[model samples]
Target chain A: DAGVTQSPTHLIKTRGQQVTLRCSPISGHKSVSWYQQVLGQGPQFIFQYYEKEERGRGNFPDRFSARQFPNYSSELNVNALLLGDSALYLCASSLRHRGETQYFGPGTRLLVL
Target chain B: DQQVKQNSPSLSVQEGRISILNCDYTNSMFDYFLWYKKYPAEGPTFLISISSIKDKNEDGRFTVFLNKSAKHLSLHIVPSQPGDSAVYFCAAPDTSGTYKYIFGTGTRLKVLA
Candidate 1:
C-alpha cells in the first residue's frame, strides 16, 4: 500500500502570499495531521483531522488552518505568509486512536521570500 | 519554553557500535512517548514508542525507554549501521485533549563505516 502522499513537493511564495499544501493518507488511514519542521528543528504539530472533523489543533496562530475531506485527504493553508513561514510542511496519517504512532509523508518544502 | 528537549545536537559512532540518543520532557501529564527517524529530505518515520505503563519497548535493533519520574526517554540502536544514521526526534502527546505532540529539537546520528 502506498504511504502518506503529499502534493507539490516544493513551493515558493512571497511575503503576504498564501499557500496550500495537500496530503492524501494511506489506503486505510482515517486520521491526518499536519506538522512544520524548520531547519535544524523537530517537526511541530499544526492540526489534526479525523472523520472530516477538526479533532485537534496545535499552537499555531489563526493564520494557519486545515480541513479534511470526506475521503480522508487533508489540506493545510497558511495565509499572509512571512519569511519565517518557510519550512518543510509534513502530513502524517494514522489510525483513529487518540494517541498513536504517525506515519509521515515526504512533506512539501515551502520557501517564502 | 521547550517542553521536550534533546540536548545533544549530533553524535558519531563507528559502525557496529551502540548509538544512544537522549530526550527529556518537563510535562508530567505526558502519558505517551515516541521516537522517530528522519532522512535528509524525507519526513519522519516512527521508530519505536513506549507508553507510561512500560519502561521499554524493543523492535529489532531499535529500543525506546521511558522514565516517568525523570520525564525522560531515550532511544538505543544496537550494532548501529551506516543506514541507521539519521535525525532522531523524541515526542510526547499533549495533555490538553487535542491529541497533539510536542517534539524535541532532534539529534543527528552519524554511523561511520
Candidate 2:
C-alpha cells in the first residue's frame, strides 16, 4: 500500500505571507500528526489529530494550525511566516492514537524569505 | 527542554562493522522509544522501537537497547551497509499521553565502503 503522502513537495514564501501544506494518511489510518524539522535538528511535534479531532498540540506559536478531515487527510497552515519558519514540514500517520508506530511522508520543504 | 537528545552529531563506520547511535531522554515517564532513519529530502522511516518493560529488542541486523536507569537508548546495526548511511533519530511519545512524539537532534551515520 502507498505510504503517507504530502503535497507541494517544495514551497517558497515571504515574511508575513501564509502557506498551507497538505498530507494524506495511509489507507485505513485514522491518526495524523504534523512536525517541523529545521536543519541539523530532529522533527518537532506541531499538532496531532485523531479521527478528525485535535488530540494534541506542540509549543508552536498561534501562527501554526492544523486540522484533519474525515478521510484522515490533514493540512498545516502557517500565517505571518517568518524566516525562522523555513523548514521541512512532515506528516505522519498511525493506526491509532496511542502506542502505535507512525509512518511518515516525504515532507514539504518550505523556505521563507 | 529537549526531552530527547542525541549528543553525537555524526558517526563514521566501515562497512561490515557495527554502528552504534546513542540517545538520552529526560523524562522517566516515557515508556516507549523509537528509532527512525531518514535520507536527504525524505521523511523519517521507522527503524525499531522498544518498550521500557524490555531491555533489548532486535530485528534483522538492527538492535535497540534501553537502559531505564540511565535514561539512555542505543541503536546497533551489525555489519552495517553503505545504504545505512543516513541521519538516525530517536523519539519518544509525549508525556501528556498524546500521540505526539518528541524527537532527538539526530545522529548522522556514514557507513563507508
Candidate 3:
C-alpha cells in the first residue's frame, strides 16, 4: 500500500503571506499529525488530530493551525508567515491516537522570504 | 527545557564497521522510545522502537538499546552500509498524555565505503 502522501512538495512564500500544505494518511489510518523541521534540527510536533478531532497541539503560535477531514486527510495552514517559518512541514499517520507507530510523508519544504 | 537530546551533530564510520548513535531524555514519563531515519528530501521513516519494559530490541542490522536508569538510548547499526548514512532521530511520546511526540536534535551518520 502507498504510504502517507503530502502535496506541493515545495513552496515559496513572503512575509505576511499565508500558505497551506496538505497531507493524506495511509489507507486505514485514522490519526494524522503535523510537525515542523528546521535545518539541522529534528521534527517538532505541531498538531495532532485523531478521528477528526484535535487531540493535541504543540507550542507553535496562533499563526499555525491544522484540521483533519473525515477521510483522514489533513491540512496545515500558516498565516502571516515569517522568515522563521521556513522549514519542512511533515505529516505523519498512525493507526490510533496513542502508543502506535507513526508513518511519515515526504514533507513540504516551505521557504518564507 | 529540551526533553530529548542527540549530542553528536555528526558521525563518520567506515563501511562494514559498527555505527553507534546516542540520545538522552529528561522526561521519565516517556514509556516508549522510537528511532527514525531521514534522507535529504524525504520525511523520516519509522525505524525501530522499544518499550520501557524492555532494555533492548533488535532488527535485521539495527539494534536499539534503552537504559531507563540513565534516561538514555542508543541505535547501533552493524556492518554499516553507505545507504545507512542519514540523519537519525530519537523520539518519544509527550508526557502530557497526548499523541504528540518529542524528538531529539538528530545525529547525522555518514558511512564511508
- lDDT by residue for model 3 over B72-106, one digit each (tens)? 99999998999999999999988686878889999
Query: Which stretches of candidate 2 lie above 4 Å from their native place?
Result: none
Worst 10 residues of 2 chain B by lDDT: B93-102
**What lDDT tens digits, residue by residue, belong to model 2 across residues B40-98?**
99999999999999999999999999999999999999989999999999999976767
Q: How many residue pairs clash per model?
A: 0, 0, 0
lDDT of 2 at B98: 75
TM-score of structure candidate 1: 0.96
Q: For residue A105, give model 2's deviation from the true position in Å.
A: 0.4
Cα displacement (Å) at residue A6, model 1: 0.3
Task: State each candidate's chain A TM-score.
Answer: 0.97, 0.99, 0.99
Ranking 1 against 3 by DockQ, winner: 3
